[model samples]
Structures are given as structure tokens and as C-alpha cells.
Target chain A: MRHTIPPRSGAAFTLERGQRLTVIDPEGEQVADLLAFSRSDIDEVISSGRSLDYASRIFLTTGDALYSNRSNVMLRIVEDTVGRHDFLLTPCSADTFRILYDDAEPHRGCFGNLAHALAPYGIGPDRIPVAFNVFMNVAVDGDTGALAVRPPLSRAGDRIVFEAETDLIIGLTACSAPQSNNFAFKPIEYEISS
Target chain B: MRHTIPPRSGAAFTLERGQRLTVIDPEGEQVADLLAFSRSDIDEVISSGRSLDYASRIFLTTGDALYSNRSNVMLRIVEDTVGRHDFLLTPCSADTFRILYDDAEPHRGCFGNLAHALAPYGIGPDRIPVAFNVFMNVAVDGDTGALAVRPPLSRAGDRIVFEAETDLIIGLTACSAPQSNNFAFKPIEYEISS
Candidate 1:
């Protein structure tokens, strides 16, 4: 009935300016896989990240902001769960795939995914040299104890919002991170704003 | 090292040919999140349905030659495995950092992790796109039991290799899809060849 995303609970929420939605994982742990782009141009990639590097953190909870490569702002974390964030483990092309299939060479893993996605826009993986990791969290273990890979503050059901800088293309997917709270992969949720 | 990806006792395997990597959800009951691309370029978005439809079911596989907006073929999926592979997902933006912490966003998630590990090459999110999920069975059941999803028959540790269609970039991430099978979010493995 509206230009919106339906919650897993079976309710639809239209994303508007200052209007937000909270997609719940229901599970104890959920990793919100978020991707934002310009409202005017859905091709621009958003710029996001975590700083304090804490654990159990959430996004859009008054901490992170979605940015663009042109240095434009997209969304901002107005709410959060867990506590910290990390924009470090984004995917790309590397030698992993090459070695697995018995090919002739190696490549980068991170840029591979992005390169295929930008085909309509006339871009290439070579043009992709940077990216961001939104709500995903990380915990780096040190000798004494595990380091707070991100800050620690976000809890479940937290929310975030971003003002699109242009028409943007978003691709969202949860993670099965081997390096998170546990090797056990969890589900997550999020919302967007004009 | 052996060109073969050792089989994990309970993992799945795929034979990737035709320049595209087909991820079979061995659980037969679970959906897989397919992530891949040609490393030669990063702006292409392989994870979207519209893009896949435009590219045909031959969605970027281990060897499906990916052509850029400039009509350039990027890297190919050299190898494949069900237990392990690099799939691109999740990341933060500049706005994400400003929202989560007092300073900047942290770099932790897959996209973040990738950018950090490959930052030396100057690869970033703006250059990438959300990856496509291949052979990943997602069952959105309707009122009809008429839709019977096929069981994904893959052997654990079985792998496929690809000859590069062009210089490529490959990103991978074992998915945690719960749609097909009870969604235990069991981990899958992948191995690349080149």
C-alpha cells in the first residue's frame, strides 16, 4: 500500500524524512546488513563505519553516518544496539576463489562483488578502490583478552536513519562472520530515511 | 599446496564452470547466499535480482565472463567450494562512524574487513556493489504447497575450478541463509582455483 519495506513481523513501514523503522532480528543476535546510496542516484555507495571499535554494538544509534565517495552524506545512526561498529571487513576479490577452482591466476575478493554490481553504470572493479562496513561488528582477541573490536552499546531492535545524498542502490545481507561474538552466524535488521 | 579444497566432513561442493560460480545449498532445505564477481572491476552489482535477470541465470559464476559498462570482462571464478568462499556483504559509511562514536566509525564487518585488508590497493565501497546470491534457495512460501523447492545435492568439500574469462576480482562469504532448511545458519565452506 505504500512505498516501503515490510517488517519480518508482517507490517509495512514507509521510509520518509525523519521517519524510521526498526527491523527486529527476534533472535538474541542479529547482524543488520545495510547498504545505502544517493536518493537522487541509486548508484552512489554510502560511506559508513565504526570508530571506538566496541562489541555488541548497533548502528544508526547516534554514532555512525552514511557517506558517499563524492564525500556526500547519506544516513546517520540515530540509534544503536551492541555498542561499537567496524568498517573493516568489507568483501572484495582476492586469491581465495582462484585457488579453490583450479584456475590460472589470483584476484582481489572485495572488489569482485562490487564490480559485477556496477555494470549498468559503466564502472569497473578497477574503479572500485574503497568501501564501508555499516552495522557489522567485530571482536579482535589479544593476548590478555578479546579486544573490543568496536564500541559496546547497541542492543537489539536499535535504529538508524540517513538522508540520501542522491539516488542510491542498496544491497543488504546479514553476515555469518567467523570472527564475531561467536562463529555462529546471526540475523539483523535496519531502516532508512529520505 | 594441493589445488584441491579438502572436504570438510559436513560441507558441500560445487563444480563451477561457464565463468560463473553456482553455490549449491547442500542442506537442500536451506537457501544459499551466493557472492562472487570479476576482480578486474568493482562497480558492477551482482547481488540484485534485476541485474541477474539482465545477465541471465548465468549470474556471475566462477567462470561466467563478467562484462563491465565498458563491456570489459573482469576476472572469473577460478574455483569453488560449498564450505568456503569469499562473498561480499555489510559495511559502514562515513555517516556510520559519526553516529556510533565520538570520533570515526570502526572497520569490522566483511566490507570493512575487506577494505582494511586491501586498502593498500585503494579499493573502497564506492567501487563495489552488493554481491549476488547464486544457487541460493530462498523459499517464500505462498498459500500453495505447489512450490516444492528442489533439494541442493552437493558433496561436502567438492570443488570447481574456472579459467579466467578476463582479469577478475572475486569476493566471497559463506552464507547463513535459513529460508530453505530450518535455517540453522550452518556454515558452508568454499575453495577457489586459478
Candidate 2:
């Protein structure tokens, strides 16, 4: 399966166990919030906290496994063109705009987009979990411990591949953070294959 | 609606806008993971990060609004018998077992319980988000900023109430951490009324 997720919008698909899904940042600078859930059970979804605990690393790279909250293997990173995928930050949402920025106007964020995309599956807002920030550049200052979100380090056409360990429903949203220099966040191309 | 969530187990329900939900620690000294989502959208779910940012405080109490990731108000703390609630930690999951403890046996945790409880609603593991640890005594070292999870501080019958701002789904789990002297973790009584 292959599809294009337009800027400021999102998409969802089901990937069978043992299949591989690759998300491509065709424009390089855009961040894609990649989320996943077990197809058979929604509660057996991917958890970043569990992934960090099992992998013992914050940033994900090829060969790392994404674990579910139950400690089951969900997805394994099989390939990566950009090695700096971030699991530290939560996906951008409307609260992000109201609290972090001074903007009063309603801003469409990945949270809303993901919810809209997954609605057809009978998944609502309460079911959306934290996402993997693909191609996002987040720098943690060693001395101060302050976190900074930078522009993507990935070049155009860079992609990250994950092999599913279980039947899964995947959601992807082109992040809407204008401060990340992703003002004109571009579409993302995704392909899933066995 | 009213129900009792047994120790090591959980339950889920939907609360209409303007309704109130109260969670009671009847015997006290127990921790409950309280989570919520927008009934209309799953991606615009509750966000602890956004809640802290909007409330401008670490601890939640009366008048504090629980903000969704999209910055929308999901619930407002309207009353409380115990003032301490933790929004900093992720619920204990199976990965927490693997990383934090040396025990080889599989241990039940809030993550699994929430998943099971929400299964009938078509919610799975991936939908579970970071939760509010209610009545869990987490002491933050003033100088070092290190956190220690202690036993609950509230006495019997202590409760916290929230008025729903949106149509919402709520999940609660009696925390399964044995180290916190919650080995005999008791059931929690919850009531949702308009």
C-alpha cells in the first residue's frame, strides 16, 4: 500500500504483521507524527515510554524496536536514511498552540488531523496516543538540559522503515509547527510492503 | 453511572459535557491512574504537557482545567478532598517492569488494566496516553529535583471531582506498583452524574 499525506492533513492504514512500512519525507524539512495501534486490540498500542525503556535509548535508529505498553514488540526499525527520529516530544496539538505560543486563533495540528483521519475506524480523540516524530530535530543541551526543536536534519527523499511485529493500524500527520520552519509543511509519501 | 474498579483492574466510560466524575479512595493509600479523551476525536486527547503549560502549575486542584493536546478544555477540577495529583509520570507499564525491576516474572500494571477495560470500546493499547496519577505520593526533591514515588497521603473516603467540559471517555486503573506499599491495592469507587 502506498499513499500521500498532504500538508496539515493525515492518513491511516493497516499493515499486516511482518510487513514493512516506510515513511518518506520528500521535502526533507517536514516532521511527520507517526502513530501506531494493534489492529486486534487498541490497548496493545505503541508506547514511547516502553520503547525507551526496552531500547535504553531516547533517539531511535535502525534496528531499534518499538514496544507496546505491555512490553510486546510492535515495530522494529529496519532502515533509516536519517538517524535522528525523536521519541521525546508529544505530537503537536491545539494545546501546543495555546500554551507554548501566543496565538489565540485556532490552529490545526497533527492531533486534530490524526483524530479526523482515524474517525472512520471508530477511533476518537481519547484513543490517540503519543507519536513518533519522524525527521524532527530535537536537541537536548547537555549542560543546561534545555530542549530545543530544530529543523529537520533529513535531506529530501530521506525515509525511515519499520517492520511490523503485529497487525497494525498506522496514522501519519504532517506536523503543523510553523516555528520549526515547516511553515509550508509538505506532503509525505508512505509505502507498506510485505 | 457508578462502579467499583478492583485492584489490578480498571474500567472505562463516557461522560457527557457538563457532567461530573468523582473518584474516591475509600481506604486511602492507593494510587489511581485517571485518563480521559475527547469523545468526538481521539487525536485531540488529554495531554499532561499541555495541562501543565496552561495551568502554570505542577499539581492539580480546584479550578485547574485539564487541557487536551489541542488546547481544548476536557475536564475541570471542581472539588477535591486530597489536593495532590501527579501528572508527571507515565502509567506503570510492562516495559516499566523490564527496565525498573530485576524480576523475571510478568507483572500486571496499569497499562494492561486500562487496555483491557477499554477493549469493549474498541480502544487498544496504542490509544492509552500518559495519565494523571491520583493520590500517588510522588515527592520531588527540592534541590536535586529527583522524584520518589511514595505511598498515598489521603485517608479513607478522600476523593477528587472533575466537571467534564467536553463529551469525554474516562479510564481509571488502580496502580499495580508493589514497591509503593500498594501490594493490596484496593478497589476505587467512581460516580459520574450530570
Which candidate's lDDT is highest?
2
lDDT for each residue of candidate 2 in A83-118, tens digit (9 for 90 to 100): 886665566667677667767984768888988888
lDDT of 2 by residue, B31-128 (tens): 88988877776556677656764554557788988887666889999998888777656677665776677557746588888888777766666667
lDDT of 1 at A106: 42
Q: Ten-residue segment with the worst summed lDDT in candidate 1 chain B?
A: B138-147
Interface RMSD of each: 16.8, 6.6
TM-score of chain A of 2: 0.95
The DockQ-derived docking category for candidate 1 is incorrect
Query: What's the DockQ of model 1?
Result: 0.03
Each model's Cα RMSD: 17.4, 6.3
Best by TM-score: 2
Number of clashing residue pairs, candidate 2: 16
> Against the true structure, what is model 2's DockQ?
0.12
Candidate 2 iRMSD in angstroms: 6.6
